[model samples]
Target: MSRRVLIKTLPLHTNYGGIVQAYALQRAIRDLGHRAVVDTGDPISLRRRVLHRAWAVRRAVRMLLPARVDWDWRASREVLAPQQSFVRRHLSRASAVERADTRRGRARLARRFDTFVVGSDQVWRAAYAEIPEQFLEVIEEFHGPRPRRVSYAASFGRDDIDEYSEAERARATELIRRFDAVSVREESGIGICADAFGVHAERHLDPTMLLTPGHYRGLVARARTDPTPAAGRTLVYRLDATDDMLRAERAIAERVGAPAMELLPTASPGSYGEYAADRARFDRPSVERWLASIASADFVVTDSYHGCVFSILFNRPFVVHANARRGAARFDSLLGVFGLEHHRAGASADGIDDRVFTPDWSHVNRVLEAERARATAYLVENL
Candidate 1:
């Protein structure tokens, strides 16, 4: 008996990790012989599209005001073209099917699926984005009072629920209690489920890690034209640009004995230092090219959870810049899985005690295989 499962996660955007996770989960579901459907994308109205374009132009103009604000809209536009092209090529098959951003649209979309899944990102966190209150409404739009509802690898992105307001806490508690099954990407999220929501949530690996290295290598193979980072280059894929993260990145680069290839392109105004140049290079590579860069890099240094996940998947030696501002506990939880916790670095880079930069791949692989089995079983049982 086949079932149509609708995955209700974050919208597909330019974020490499987000896109990859969505792809992996859908692939994993389909591998179990279940049919999975994700909304193609939200339909932006003409008025909103005009406002977005206007906002982009206004910001671009403000950046060009005198202080060498270090921004370029042309570069941004050019960079986004390839990123979107990647989506159209790889994800459009399963995803280019629905766009439900309205009441009638959601109701119509609900009629096409038998089950609904909500998860696999910082989507549980209110501040990650301005996700509409109606994202959960799709589940209720079903013909019955209850439709199969599961949350897979959902993350609150923090150690505590104190960030949510009183009303938010109540809403989360009520909504999560309705979930037939619940699994979170981070260990801390388990505690959040118990303490904040009174819901028992199992801890599961991020969907990206559910796939094998060969799976990612295949993506890279298909993207043959995408240039990878130069061999022996230290890939610096930071999500946050704190002074401590920069120091941590430099130290890892030195330890790896290679020139650093910084991949992220975000910098705040008036910030000085080596990362200042990042603002001018906002053209983050296509998702496939980004994967290629990580796969080929001699070593990786990152403050991103997905960065560490990809480094492990690609067998790249790496160090984690455990930036507290970006939820440092996530680093601890991810590294703990492969016994690579020593690879974590603090603001001053002192927390990193793993002198031998590389982990025991044999040990990590064994752990990966075991965890992958458990994670897969979780998907199977729930599906």
Candidate 2:
């Protein structure tokens, strides 16, 4: 029998991984013969909306008012426009739930589905600790039939649960105990659930990993009727771009005798003014183009987790720069799973050239196949 599954995660965020993970999970669920939808409607108060705009204004001022302006507002828009479009066309259709902030609102939302899922990202992180009642979907004193609650690959962002206060922690533990089934993205997250909440959460692969490379290839190919063939060029996708990382990318491009292409942020433009302008004007690539960029790259250098994920999926040689700001546990756990620990690059360019080598696909594919099955099985049994 087909069941309706509603997934609640941090999908409204602009991050590529966050968006893609939501899409992947929904797709995976549907592939298992169930109807899956993402709860993209998170009720934001007027005050929060005003604060968000203020934050954007501040960031824009900082990026634009610099002495030698390193970021371009228009260029950022060009990069993000397609990504936003992709979400609208591909993801928004499944988003039927309305914004629910109050108990009444949540109950109305809950009545729409049979099962509610929280996660595949840092939905349980400390920053969201205060809203555990909503984001975690554990409402109190409702007379209506309760939906089965579960978490798939939910992460805490960090290894420990120190972000929550003592009171908050106690409340969170109580809420967690209410989940019918729980799973985490990282192995350390499993420990966190056990020690912090006394909950035995299973570890599962990221949703992006749940889908095969062919699934992505088909999506990208459909978006681009006239696909750009691989030209053995170096693709640089940096979420947290740094001077050292840029230098390494340039050096690698020089060594390979191919131009270095970058996937810059739509919110924070980089210092490459002319390149940014050119991309904004002529080569405004959408999410499809972004995927194609990674698919056709001869080599890739990136700090983003999804960036590294696509590189591996396409079987491209790549180097991952450590992005500690986003938390290293995610990268460490993922790399360790695929046995690609040596792919991590240092801040310096030392031995970087030597680090670029084809991965052992025979081993990596085997691991991915097994892990994918396990992840699918967990969802099948739970949902």
Best by TM-score: 2
Q: Give the TM-score of candidate 1.
A: 0.82
What TM-score, over all chains together, does every model reach? 0.82, 0.83
Compute the lDDT of residue 17 as modeled in candidate 1.
84
The Cα local distance difference test for each model comes to 0.73, 0.76
What RMSD does model 1 have? 5.5
- Please report, as a residue range, the 10-residue window in candidate 2 with the lowest summed lDDT: 92-101
lDDT of 2 by residue, 1-383 (tens): 78888888875546777888888998998988988878755555557767878998987677565434545555455556777887877773443343455567668767877888887777877775334643354444456878888899988877887777787788778878988999999889989889988989998988988888788878887886334444567888888778888788887778767787766533434544754555544344566767777888888889988888888877888889968777678778888898898888887666764646657888888988999899888998999
Mark the regions of model 1 whose C-alpha exceeds 4 Å error after superposition. Answer: 40-75, 93-107, 130-135, 141-145, 226-228, 265-282, 349-351
lDDT of 1 by residue, 247-356 (tens): 87787677668998878666323332222455455456778778888888898888788898988887888887776776776778888888887777666655677643
Candidate 1 local distance difference test against the native: 0.73
Model 1, position 6, has a per-residue lDDT of 72
Task: Give the C-alpha miss distance for residue 235 in model 2, angstroms.
Answer: 0.7
